[model samples]
Target: MSRQVQINKIVGRLVAKKREAVSLTQEDVAGRLNLNTESYGRIERGVTPLTVSRLVKLATLFQCGIDELVLETSTGLTGQAQYIANMLDGVSSSDRDEIVKIVEKICALSHKKHLKSIKPY
Candidate 1:
C-alpha cells in the first residue's frame, strides 16, 4: 500500500478503537458526527478520505487532537499501527479493553515526556 493509504488505515483503526473504548458503536459515532452509518463505516474502513472539518469533529468527539486522529501511529500511527492493530485483532474483547487503557496511558505519558524533553531549560 502507498504510505498515504497505510496512514489512512492506521488512522481508521485508531478511530474505530477510540470509539470502541468509549463504548460507542459505529452507529453511535456516525450519529454524533451527523453522518450515516455507511459514511462513518467508510471513514472507519479508510475507504473515504477525511475532510479537515470532519476530522476536527472527530477529534473533539474523541477528546484527542486532529493530529492524533489523522497522523496515524501510536506516535503518528502509520504502517506500524496497522501491524499493531492487526495483532490486537486476536485479543478478546475484555482483554482488548485493558490493553487499550494501557496503551492510552502509555501514549499520554510518552507525549508528556516528549514535551518535557523539548523544553529549553
Candidate 2:
C-alpha cells in the first residue's frame, strides 16, 4: 500500500478502537459526525481520505487531540502512547505526574505477575 494509505488505515483503526472503547457503534459515530453509515464505515476502513477539519471534529467527538489523530513517528511513540498523550493535553503537571506514577505502579505489578507465571529454567 502507499504510505498515505497505510497512515489512513492506522488512523482509521485508532478511531475505531477509541470509539469502541467508549461503547459507541459505527452507526452512532456516523450520526454524530453527520455522515451516512456507509460513508462512516468507509472512513473506519480507510477507504476514504480524512480531511483536517473532519479529523478535528473526530478528535473533539472522541475527546482526544489532533496530534493523536495525525502524528505517526517511526522513532517516537504511536498508538496507545499517542492516545495517552492526547488524554494529558489539558491536564495539570501535578495530575500528569500522578497519572505517570499510577501507570508505573501498574506496569511494575503486571511485570511481577508475569514473572511469577514463568516456569523456572
Candidate 3:
C-alpha cells in the first residue's frame, strides 16, 4: 500500500479502537457526525479517506488528541504523553503547574517502588 493509505489504515484502526473503548457503536458515531452509517464504516475500515474536519470532529467526540488519531507510530508512554500534552495545550499556567506536580509525584513514587524492588549489589 502507499504511505498515505497505510497511514489511513493505522489511523482508522486507532479511531475504531478509541470508539470501542468508549462503548460507542459505529452507528452512534455516524449519527453524531451526521454521516451515513456505511460512510462512517468505510472511514473506520480505511476504505474511505477521512477528511481533516471529520478527523478533528472525531477527536473531539472521542475526547482525545488529534495526534492520537493521526500519528501511527506513537504508542505506549510516548503516545500517552503526546495525548496529555495535547490536553494541556490550552490550559492556564496554574492548571498546568498542578498537573505537573501530580505527574511528578506519581513518577517519584514509581521510582521509589522500583528502587525497593531491585536487589542492590
TM-scores of the candidates are 0.56, 0.64, 0.64
Model 1 error, position 35 (Å): 1.4
Candidate lDDT scores, in order, read 0.80, 0.83, 0.88
Better of 2 and 3 by lDDT: 3
- By TM-score, how accurate is candidate 3? 0.64
Can you write out model 3's per-residue Cα lDDT over 29-99, one digit (the tens) per residue?
Answer: 99999999999998988888888999999989998778778776456988778778777888999999999
Residue 67 lDDT in candidate 1: 61
Tens-place lDDT digits, model 1, residues 1-121: 8887887777788788877877789888899888899999988898887788888888888776566576545455466776576577668999999998999999999999999889685
Alpha-carbon RMSD, candidate 2: 5.3
Preferred candidate (TM-score higher): 1 or 3: 3
Per-model tally of clashing residue pairs: 6, 0, 0
Model 2 spans > 4 angstroms off: 72-121
- Please give the lDDT score at residue 79 for candidate 3: 74
Q: Candidate 2: worst 10 consecutive residues by lDDT?
A: 69-78
